[model samples]
Target: MTNLLSTSNQEEFGLNVLIIDDNEQITKMISSFLDMSNYECTVVNDGKEGLDLIKTNQYDSIILDLAMPEFDGYEILDALQRENPSYLSKIIVLTASNVPIENIQKFKELGISSCLQKPVDIDQLLSKIIDSSV
Candidate 1:
């Protein structure tokens, strides 16, 4: 997993990914996998903190969980819609709850790159991340 790439090629392939989830284990697993895949990862457990980071830093992709405490994903999305709509294209929403079809459509309307359920396949997630970045 420590096979580092050349500095130039790394810049071409590596993406700065921010993963925001209340579940520590999920974040750790995703971050580790992305790190091994040559993507830099930042993990945030609190939605409020995650929102702050989203506002202050630029990341190539954001993996966001819809259910979280102290300012949930909807709040973050709403805030971004108001002030940072461009970032929506780089966001992949993940939720365990059974979201309504209308809400799912809303997500697409908001320009989210993808919406995935919990227990997502790592490979598919990686594919979405790559595709969205492209």
Candidate 2:
């Protein structure tokens, strides 16, 4: 298990994190890591299903992928922002896309929490979560 869980008051916070990615392997890896901690995580393989889950439940955070089948993360973001403004602050973009600088800037302007590239660093992700929770 990751060390961050032992140091943080994760149980008190009751973090609910949603991961939206089409890649099953990536999703499993992320879920396993999160489950080892105090995070209550839900993974969805399709963007449409991810968006539906988001609308149906409340989450402390969301890790979104740029590309997926049925619907893309961008569309899901737009829809969520329109329906639930508060969720805007909780969304984090986690994708393998080589996005442009301008696009990254736009995401920041839209109030996304953070953007994590592909081959995500476990340490970095844990740090972000711990920091955000605080």
State each model's CA lDDT, in order.
Answer: 0.87, 0.81
Number of clashes found in candidate 1 = 0
lDDT of 2 by residue, 83-112 (tens): 876776777788888978987897788777
Off by over 4 Å in 1: 1-11
Error of 1 at 89 (Å): 0.7
Give lDDT: candidate 2, residue 45: 90
Over the stretch 1-134, how does candidate 1's per-residue lDDT look in tens digits? 23334335555668999999999999999898778768989999999999899899989899999989878999999999999999999899988978889989999998999999988877678778877776
Q: For model 2, what is the error of residue 54's alpha carbon versus the real structure, in angstroms, after optimal superposition? A: 1.1
Candidate 1 lands at a TM-score of 0.89
